[model samples]
Target chain A: MSMSPYSFRLAAQSLHREKWINLLSVLTIASGLLVISVALLVAYNVNAATGKLPEKFALTVYLNDNLGREKIDALIGALKKKQSVAQVRFIPKDEAMKELKTMLKNANYVFEGLDENPLPDSLEIRLKREAVSPEEVKKLTGDIGRMQGVAEIDYGEKFLAALHSVKSGVRTVGLSIITIIVAGIIFVCYSTVKILFYRRTEEIETFKLLGATRAFIRAPFIIEGGVIGMAGGLISLMSVYVLYYVVLTRMSSVVPLLSNILFPLDLFLLLPLSGLLLGVAGAVIAVGRLRY
Target chain B: MIQFSNVTKDYENQTALRDISFVIEKGEMAFITGPSGSGKTTLLKLIYSAEKPDRGNISVAGWDLDQLKASSIPYLRRNIGVVFQDFRLLGNRNVFDNVAMALRIRGMGEREIRTKVFETLKSVNLRHKSDSYPKGLSGGEQQRVVIARAMVADPTVLLADEPTGNLDPDTAESVMRTFKDINARGTTMLIATHNRELYRNTGRKVIRLEGGTLVGVGPG
Candidate 1:
């Protein structure tokens, strides 16, 4: 059905006539959207933080102090042959001791009185980015610890597991919240349009007698729902931006790390578009179910 | 043209119209006059497909009412106009928009709608009240606005139920003149009223019903 300008005019007139009711609907939808947006923001930041951790991830393989140079070289070769291994750097006992001494330069007297270097020779192993999951790291460490010259493997097992856990948890909870909020927004539009339809029962009956089609009678309501949804989306978007700005510019001084939160400005533009689609869907359902 | 062959309609506990038959030829203006509860309104509703007959067939403008699908009812209605006893004007809208509703339903543009609505209102002698709301209009003026709305789209047939029920003698005569003018323009008309004065000596066909049966058919 073609949308006539008269439908738009009727919708505008209805919106003006029921301004208070429309405002209430918009505010309810906006509050729901704002909650969902904030939940999404938290999920995004947590995912980003967890995603970057893998780039600097490393597995330190401590070696036996008496291992020969050839054995160390062989171990390095074996590790490099593994598909998961990206790089391997061998540090001899003397170099390790020298690094420790440099790290303790502020208290040089403590090391100057030591009789011998007790540091172990180790191989710093970096893995492919895709293989940096907690399970993969655990399996790789297990295999290395079983190798001939390997003494122990230090991959911070607890920390890596906690990071992955946090990421997954945020995603699951965020999705659930978003789903509930979206349903709420749709319900708001549906109820509002239904009330408006009932309020105009006389007009609808008059239109029917005037030879108006179902589409013609329903067009104004659909337009009203879409306008309400889009307006709600716009209001929520503005609220989110204001909150982001306040956190970044004002509250960051108290909690400095809040400044590092990344805002996906481009992606957030979908809020109003989503709201419009949902609003139209709600109106369609409300009108479709009613007896004319 | 409208034809009813052996038509019968029944409510839950009462028969409204039963085994009734009549025909109003194309471009003919006729009247159905009966007392209250004599099924005059039900007969007008049947022609417009608002109420279906329990038996027999009805043909209006060549459309078989018995076979008309629900989806096609609106298209059928688009070619017919009904003026109600209650006026049925939108209280919130002014006189112009109320008349413009019929044309707007057909997706006419504003420029054309404005011209047609003004002309129709002028025909009803209410063009001066175009900006007035229905609450501000007298019963006669409101009735004229309803007539303007029904005539705005230029349908093939017009039906009126108690068209001048609430008006005084002068207003009722003026409204009758308006219906005659519209009928003069070659639109078929069927008016249902209990008052015999409307069709007493108009020299038009009159179908009379009493107690759910066709008691008589003659000329006014």
Candidate 2:
């Protein structure tokens, strides 16, 4: 049977009558969805930022202090011949010192009394896309370490591996937690609808006697559950937007990196859609459990 | 039209109807008079498929309940009206909604449902009480509202169980008069009641039962 206007009216009446229960359900769903949204936002930004880092990955090849310019040219030529080696740039001793001072900034006073520029000339070897992964980078570094004029090789391998591990861990844990919260939202909707159904047993029985199909009796409860979920979804969207705004405005001032991350505008639609699905699923479960 | 061929029903600890056999012609009015636990309510329940028989078969308005599918039960029920002793009307809904429920479930147009519900309410003398809730109406008025709800869809058969069990003689008679008026319009009726005065001198077919067994069947 088709759903009538009375079905919506019935849902509205029930929602109004049980305001406290509906409110509690909405709050629970909203809080859960908020957590999900925040997690998704963080995960997406971290992945996006890290995904860009591999393209900038570089291997620093330090040359021997006493080596002649010709030896350095030979090493650069060797690096350029390697597979997946995109480009090589030479950083002279003075330029390295200049970059170091820039990195140290106010701490450059420690190097003021040094008799000479202790930094060695280095080759900055950039990798192609295929060599950007940890394994390929490690192999390249090992090959460069055995070369003649290369006194040392530093690719920040440990740091990149740690970042990769952290990203993987966050993705795995975040997905598990989001799944659990979605289930919780569904349970909240189910329990609320079940409670409402029991409270309206008399009305349900009357509907049956009046020749209402099983679908007719179930449609209103489902609609009511969906309404509750949508309310929760709406509240969650608002909470997340407000949270993002606060983070953007206040927190970014103290931690400038926070300014780089943003909540996707499409989440405004996706989060509510998720909540609606959860609510409908909960209603289906609650109504399916009835004897009718 | 209704038929029960050697139908028997049982609960967990006792039988509700035993080897009951009967047939009601189309447009006829009959009374099921019996003592408490004598299967009067159980028999009426069979007519509407509320309770199925453990043995034998039943047919109501040409739907063979013995082979009735669960999916088809609603359609079968749409053609058979039922009135409970407790006057099962939705307390949260106004009388108009309560009576219009039958049409609403079937997705009838609002305009048609409104006119039909109003007319049905008038027939039960509850037109003025259309906006009143069930709690605001008296016992008899609530029962009349239930009757209006049952009759609003113009069901082919009406089965009522102890419809006046909680009413005084005057109110009970008034409720019966509404049933009689609906029945006069060619709707078959089967009423279950304990009050012997209800069936006496009525010149209607009476099926008497004692201890879940049919004891007598004759004109009252």
Candidate 3:
């Protein structure tokens, strides 16, 4: 028949009479969203924490003690010309020795065997915030490798590899969590709809005999499912925000490390979107699983 | 008007209707009287396109059943009123909205729907019970609401499959009278019933069926 207010009215009445069905469905959807949102938050934080690491350390390039001070001076000048290099500091043998002595002042016996300071003369290269590209960093090191006094060029490949390892590890965990939570949401929604059908079997048969179309029979349940999902998503966002606040307060110092990396608390915006997706996805799959 | 030409229906293993053919003309009231399993209910179902015939062509009000499209089914159902044996009243709705459903499907406005639903309920003697839900209403009242719903749209044909099966004799007679009055007003009626006495007393057209085959047709 024509789309009319009557269908909506009937749907409202049906939902009212079967309040438990809708309530259970909504709770199921909300739970699914909570799992999904929390998983996303954890993944975001992990990535954010890993990205903050490289900014703290300067790359130390050891000078060839043979070609010594003059070439080390030229190497520092060449590094300053690169747009990627933010600043450079040359640590001479004397300065390196002095810093080492101060670092071991508490443990005098640790430095007792040293005739002279064995520390190398080196250039500490600080990268611009925008200049931290692994590929570009490697190329810059190769250029510095040819410098006369440069005995060895070092940007800590081990450190870069370790940082990358954390990034991939966090991503895998995030993806796995997302996949499992989505599947769980669908399973929960499917059962909720099934319960709804179970609760209203008599009413459904009546509609069928009255010549109600399949769409007519289906629309109200679908609408109910959608509403449930949306509410669930909205609720999950609030809970997630509360959790985020508690977490940030507990580990507030880590906040500065999250600068341009993860979705700032603004990433909280993505939580609702994820909620909607989970809600809608769960309802469709749940609805499709049922048969009359 | 309705025509069935060599119509048959089968489930997975059992046949529900045989190669049955029949025609009921416009403005006629006919009873498909038969024992249980004689395909009486299945016959009415086919008229409403609730279930399609496996083989053969059936047409209702000039619409071909064989080639009916999905969109056209609702259009077909809208023009033919159906009163189920079990009443089929939506238990969640009040009597007013229940009877108003048929008219509401025609996209009638709220004001007009209220007026028309009240008028239809008055005709069914159910106006006083308008606010009561189906579960609160008596069996006869529920059937009456269903009848009111069926007649509210003033459809081309009315199909009732044992509309009185669930009611007592007195209530059944009253409901039949309502059906007769509606039929008199030029709405074709096809009622399937096992109770031969109901039709005999009402002096309506009666057709007999046995094992999915029409046995005899009696004069109205």
Indicate which candidate wins on DockQ: 1
Across all models, the iRMS values in order are 0.8, 1.1, 2.9
Candidate 2 structure quality by residue, lDDT tens digits, B123-202 = 88899999999999988889888889888999999988898887889989888998899899999999998888878999
What is the C-alpha lDDT profile of model 3 across A106-147, one tens digit per residue? 888987878876777888888876666577678888887876
In the range B100-151, model 1's lDDT, one tens digit per residue, is 9899898998899999999999999999999999999999999999999999
Interface RMSD of 2: 1.1
Q: lDDT by residue for model 3 over B13-58, one digit each (tens)?
A: 8888888887889999988988999989888888888788889899
Tens-place lDDT per residue, model 2, A1-292, is 3567878887888899999999999999999999999999989888888887777888888888979989888888888999989999999999999999899998977897899999999989888866777777888788889999889988888887987888888899899999899899999999999999999887887777677888889988999888889889999999999999999999999999999877888888988888888998999999998786
The candidate 3 chain B region of ten consecutive residues with least summed lDDT is B99-108
User: In model 1, which runs have C-alpha deviations exceeding 4 angstroms?
Assistant: A64-78, A81-83, A106-118, A143-149
Give the candidate order by descending TM-score: 1, 2, 3
Shift in Å, residue A123, candidate 1: 2.1
**Which residue segments of model 2 deviate by more than 4 Å?**
A60-124, A128-131, A139-154, B167-171
Deviation from native of the Cα of residue B78 in model 1, angstroms: 0.5
Clashing pairs in 3: A64-A149
Candidate 3 global Cα RMSD:
4.7
Native contacts recovered, in order, as a fraction for each? 0.76, 0.61, 0.27
Tens digits of per-residue lDDT, candidate 1, A131-157, equal: 988889888888998999999888878
| Of 1 and 3, the candidate ranking higher by DockQ | 1
Per-residue lDDT of B75 in model 3 = 78
